[model samples]
Structure formats: structure tokens, C-alpha cells
Target: MTLVAFRYWLAGMSLALATLVTPLSTAQAISPLGGPRFAAVLMDADTNEILYAEQATAIRHPASITKVMTLYIVFDALDAGRLRLDDRVVMTPRAVSQRPSKLGIGVGQSLSVEEAISVVAVKSANDVAVALAEKVGGSEENFARLMTAKARQLGMRQTVFANASGLPDPAHFTSAQDIAILSAAMIRHHPDRYRCFSEQSYSYGRLRLANHNKLLGVVPGLDGIKTGFTNDSGFTLTASAIRGGRRLIAVVLGSPSGWQRDRDITTLLNTGFTALDIRRNGGIEDMPALLSSAGFTLNRSLRPVPQLATLDVEEGDGE
Candidate 1:
């Protein structure tokens, strides 16, 4: 089948996998952080169970984790038959004008929806993000509206969206726990489309980009998800992995380093499975996925940027 047709079929089949739905609740979920700077969570992707939390309910800047919502809307559009992946996403001056780590797409240029998705997935291109937003919601503002609406529907109590690219916006904020919910929805409600998050690298012309999440490459069974950072948000990662039948979405917001981010993710994952295995078989044992190819670790950790260790939070750290 053609790629666009395949995309449609895949998105459609993904909706069938939405068996892991959760109902709205007023109670704030748990977080993993022991202090204000860190917020973490371990969620069972299939059952919608929050296995662990630390300051999870505290509203904080999500950084590029906002892309989680962006991708959700993209997949929703595809599933709704509103657009095709083959559709030309014509970049506007506004889209190309955004900022860096982009595909460096220029205004008046055009890329297929599939190509645009790749650009955003691999490069976290703000340009492609705006392009996708414009196409999906007619304008970045409209898309932001749609994203916040979806957030509300998903029972995200304290999250809001001001744009699609997750650019630094004073009004755009989300708690780590809310991000975990969004992450769970991405994996549980749209497994097929979420695979795009696992892409290690993609190139547009001379510029090559890599997935920001380090765990996907280094950690076995980590299939896909998104990562984000900014002066305001610090290092944030929403990562997921499946070992045996148990799946977990781990969120670490406001981390101080890429090493710490990966370290926190692995620890949470190890903790979740360790807890699950013990609960199921009465004692912890080797994970089924580990037995398949243990030591199969790859360099998921991208080269550490110096600023990563000293990344600053937004002006509104507490608010």
C-alpha cells in the first residue's frame, strides 16, 4: 500500500488499541520528585495505572513535551479523515520564521505531511511544528486551542497550551503528572502512530537531526516518545518502554542533566517492572525482554550539551 494509505490504516488500527482508557478524576496524581525541581511518574500504559509519582500534580513548564499533544492531534486528524499524510504542508513565512533545531525549511517550501512529521520527530523543528499546527488547526492559535481542549478532555487539570511547538510561552504550562497522562494516551491510544517518536535520526538536506530522548537508544525495549528542553523548562523527557507484557511511561521534568534524565528513566523503569514482576510472580526475576538480548544497549544518549547541566527554569518557577 502507498505510504499515505498505510498511514491512514495504521492510525485507524491504533484507535482499536485504545483499550487503555481512563476516566476523569479530581484527584491529583502522584509525582516522583522529592523536591520542587523534579517531577516524575511511572504509569502503566496498558492499564492506565499510575504505579508511582513524585510532585506529579505540581503545574510546571513541559518544555517540548508539548509535542506529545501535537502528535496526538496529528494522529487524531489522520484518524478522523481530515487530512492525508501525502497532503502538501506548505510552509508559511510564519512557520519558517519560528526558531532553531529545525529542518531549516524555508517559507514557500513544501513537504508532504509524512515528511513534515519526520522533521518534527527527528529534529523537533519548530518550523515543522507550526506547519503541522497550521494544517491541523488552521493557525497556531487555533491549534493551541485544540490542544488545550484535548488536554481538558483527557482530564489534564492544570495544563494549558499557547502554541503547537512548545516554544517558550508564559501561558503554556503543564505539570509532569499531566504529561504522564498525555504520554500514556499516546502509547495506549495511538500505539501505531507513536512509533514515530522512536526514530533515532533523520536528515533534511545536509542537516541531520537525532531524537532528543536518549533512553530509546540505550535502554532496551524503549520503542518511542518525545523529549524537550528550554531556558524556561529545563530538561524534560517523556519516555516509554515495554518489557514482557508490562509497559510504563516515565516522565521526568526539570531534570538537571541528560545523564540524570536517562538515569532517572532507567531507574523508574527498573523499579516499575521490578514491582510488577514481584507482584505477579511473587519475586523479582529477569525481565522477558532482557533475556532476549541483554546488553543490547545502544547509544541512545546523545552527546551531552554543556548547557544541559546548567539549564535554567522559566521565570515562573513556582507559579
Candidate 2:
């Protein structure tokens, strides 16, 4: 098949694998973040305290950040001895033809579980994410169910997984609080596998994919977790950083661009550390007042405001 035709065919296969039929206009189901077009939260990973928040419970499309849960499942499988890093998973037509921000592994090619996880974590490869779902849950739908179930188990109360790759499905939604919980859980519950999130890049075949999480090297104490975006979801990120022995989890959703998303989260993290008197860079006065002026309800509990909804791959970032 021609490459374009093959992509359509694989999309069809993925739909069949999902066994889900939502209307094409389902994008209307959830509204994207309003106001500054942002929703964010910063939490004390150790104490589970909410340091700062703005619409933390607002429902938003997670985009490729859904891969974080996908990685959680893979880590669980490895822990249970159900999957091994070196066990090669053969790429089927379905996996090879997934949409872009992909590793572009060819059909009949094989990648070990570890390699797949690295690519998914770094590149946010749609193809490899489907392969992971197939490898562990027999299909993407089943794996998504597992992801949803695990979300409940982890107290990600607002999360629902419609697909493994976090493509634009209006039904695939999560909250800033929910994603923060997932990030903290990944670090607290599975310290061993959590290291994968910090990988700068992964080499598969001739492809060398660098991680899209920009905070890794730029922000001090920033370690992981993931970044995501789509036309509907805008630019989103779930990030974790450590300073002064305390680790903080910050989730920012629905920024206009990657730079704004990073800036908002950085400000939140800096403010969080400053609040705890652990900030190395600046004091509370040095913190940006954007949170309050931009309509974020900092230092207060806020109610969920209904529903809403990629990095630029060509710019060398992954969604």
C-alpha cells in the first residue's frame, strides 16, 4: 500500500482494535481550558499537599501525556515478570502505520520492551504506544481499560483513557490534579522504572530521538515526567522537579505554545519551592505574579469547571 493509504488502514485497524465508535465531531464533548487558556497545579510529592492550583480539577484532553499512564502499565508488567526489556515485540502493520511523532519502525521490525518504553517516553511515538498496548493487554482498547482502572487505583479520580497514544479523542480526558497524582505515583510507587522518564534520548535502529521534556536540562532539579500537545489540547505538560530534598509535581495544560507552557510550569515550581523556603533561585517576591493576575486562584481550593480540551515534532519536540 502507498504510505498514505497504509496510514488510513492502520487507523482503521486501531479503531477496530479499540472497538469504540464516537462521532467524528466528538471534539465538542470537552471544552479546552478557558481564561488564559491554562490549567495548572503544583503539589508536594512527599506530603501530598496542594501548594498552588488553578482549575486543578478542570477536565482537559491529555494529548500524548496519556503515554505516562501507558508507561505505568509497562512498568507494572515488567515488575510482575509478565514482560521483559529484551523480549522483542514484533511490529505489525497496525503499529508500523500509526500517525506521526512516531519512531517509524517498519512492519515486521521488532523492538524490545525497554526500547519501546524509551521511545514512548521521549518521542511520544504513537506507533510504539500501540505496540505496548498490544504487547501487554492484547489490544489498545484493553490496555486503555487497564489504564483507566489503574488510574482509579492510583487516585487519579478524573482520568479516563480512550487510547494508549493520547491522540485527539474527546473522550480521552484528565485533570491537572489527576496528572499530578500520576506523576507522583510514578516516582513514589516505582522508583526503579521512573528513571526512564529522565532519559535524554533513545536510539532505535538509525533513529536517535531526544526527549521532548525541556525542563530536564534547563531547570535545576527538574527531572521528569512528560509533555504533550495536539491542535485541540494545545501545549500541555506534566513535570516533576526536586529541590532541597523535596520533590514537587506540576501539571500545566492548554498553553498557547511550548514556551508558554514551560514558562508557566517553571513559575509554578519556583513559587512552590519559594513557599517552602527551599528555592535556590529566588524568593517569593521574585516569583512571578502571573498566577494571580492571569486568573489562577493560587493558595485556594477551587471547584472543577466543566470539560475542555502536541509539541511541534518538526521543531524537534515530541508530543
Candidate 3:
């Protein structure tokens, strides 16, 4: 090659190397751990640094993941003295219309706020979500406005909600990053209610249900948040775990099957938790490329980053 051509190539190579070596905070440097083909994100529940992501902001219907927002507003009401666990909530016809993954609540049936929460958190109950939404905002439509307003306040720019039940509204959408941010908020803003995520099962009346969040019993210190599924959105999960004093939140959306979604989430948790100081094995022997190196490390802080970048990119542009 000519001297000029060689020098130009060398300069370009050097520039690329420098870019790779530039210092970055934990949130900015780490890429998504596994290359799943849909929206995903993992962040420090404490530091709010994104540890991993793939299409984190790709907006899609959240299915029951909508309940996370429902729980958020419910938590707010509890905080403001508008509601309480022991307070009774009467089911309305509108709440009964929500689709399945429900408590099968009858019209006029009443449950304490705490009882309703258990049914929704563990069972992913559509009926219960509507009831909570109504109790807080006087109607599901009004509560939805509250949910959207809260989303904007939390910087979930890619998210919009139409109902608390999270039924298949193409109009109701959110990103994995937004859900992670919401999950972290629920944990910090309402510890008492967030603990409900860790419970494996609950029974009300004649019905009993296991928590849809598969990681609850199997994953160490994984509790808080929810799971979701639908024909269009595939299978989805939002998971959180704390290990060695560091808390991490992970969200996976649009997996092809419920079992596969559970498996993918399990892999991420295994890597981010056990591999904190070394290499994250992700508990699988053959998928080394899917797992992260064991050496990633960061400090544990009680505070999450409060000011987030405006998540303006929508479904098409996000990731």
C-alpha cells in the first residue's frame, strides 16, 4: 500500500481503539449480557446504571406487565393515605370485564386492598388490577390518566397506558428500560408493598395461585415486579435481584414462549448475581457467548440515579 493510504488506515484504527478505551460509568459502558432477539434491560436497583440491555426501549404491549404501573399508583395512594391494605375495595362491573389471568372476581365482591394486591401480584389477576385502579382514581379511565402522568414524571417517555388490567391494547405500550425504571421505583418508593413480589403463592376464597414470576423461588434474592404474556407481545418478565449488597433489575419482553422467557431471565440473573466479581456463567455450559465475563464490578449505593435521559425514542427508533 502507498504511504498515504497506510497512514490513513492507521489513523482510523487508532481512533477506533481510543473510542473503545474511553472511560465510562457503569451504566454507559456495559452492553447487554445475552443477545436475545427482543427488548431487554438490566440496571442497578441502587445505582440505576444499566448493566445490560437489548432493544431496551423497543416499545411493545406489556400484557400483565401493566400491573407494575397499577401497583405503582396503588402504592402512591397508600402513601398518601387514600388507601390501605385492610381497607375494603368493592369490585365494579368494569373491573370484572378485564380478561383472564384474573381472580375471577364477581360483581359486588369486595376484598381488602391488601387482599386484592396479593391476588394481582401472585396471580397476575386482571380483575384485581381494575379494582385497584378504580379505588385510587374513582374510575379505570381516570386511573389510566394518573398512570400516564406518573410515567411521564418517572421519565418513561416511551410508555402509554389505556387501562390498569394491561389487556391487549396496541395503544398500551412500554419499553424494557421504562419497566426497569418502574420496578426500581416500586422497590424504593414502597418497600412494604414491593415485598409482595417475593411471595411464591397466595390463596383467596376457593382459588389458589402461584406467583407468575418464575424466578421468585429459584433465584436468590429475586423478588419484586411481575411477568406478562399475550399473542402479539410474546412472553415477558421483569425481574430484580440483590447480591453482595448490589441490586440489579432485569426485564425481558417478547420471548417466543413462556418457558423460554423464564429460561432467558434465569440466565441473566445467574450471570449478573453470581458473576459480579468474576465471570457470570449464566449456569449454562454451552452458551459462553451468551454470558458475560466474570470480572465486571461496581460499588453498591443506596441511591439510584434520579435524573434520567429523556426516553424520547419510541418503538421504531429506540433500539
Residues 189-217 of candidate 3 have per-residue lDDT tens digits of 88887888888889887777888776776
Encode model 2's per-residue lDDT on 115-167: one tens digit a residue. 88888988889988998898887778777777876777787766778888888
In order, the Cα lDDT scores of the candidates are 0.71, 0.76, 0.69
Best of the two (1, 3) by lDDT: 1
- TM-score of each candidate structure, all chains considered together: 0.78, 0.80, 0.75
The clash number for model 1 is 8
To one decimal, what is the Cα RMSD in angstroms of model 2 from the true structure? 8.3
Q: Local error of candidate 2 at 74, Å?
A: 0.7
Clash pairs, model 2 backbone: 31-307, 31-308, 31-309, 32-308, 32-309, 229-310, 230-310
Clashing pairs in 3: 32-53, 278-294, 278-295, 279-293, 279-294
TM-score of predicted structure 2: 0.80
TM-score of 3: 0.75
Q: Among these predicted structures, which one has the highest lDDT?
A: 2
Instruction: Give Cα distance to truth, residue 318, candidate 2, Å.
Output: 4.8
**Stretches of model 3 off by over 4 angstroms after superposition:** 1-37, 279-319
Model 3 lDDT on a 0 to 1 scale: 0.69
Better candidate by lDDT, 2 or 3: 2
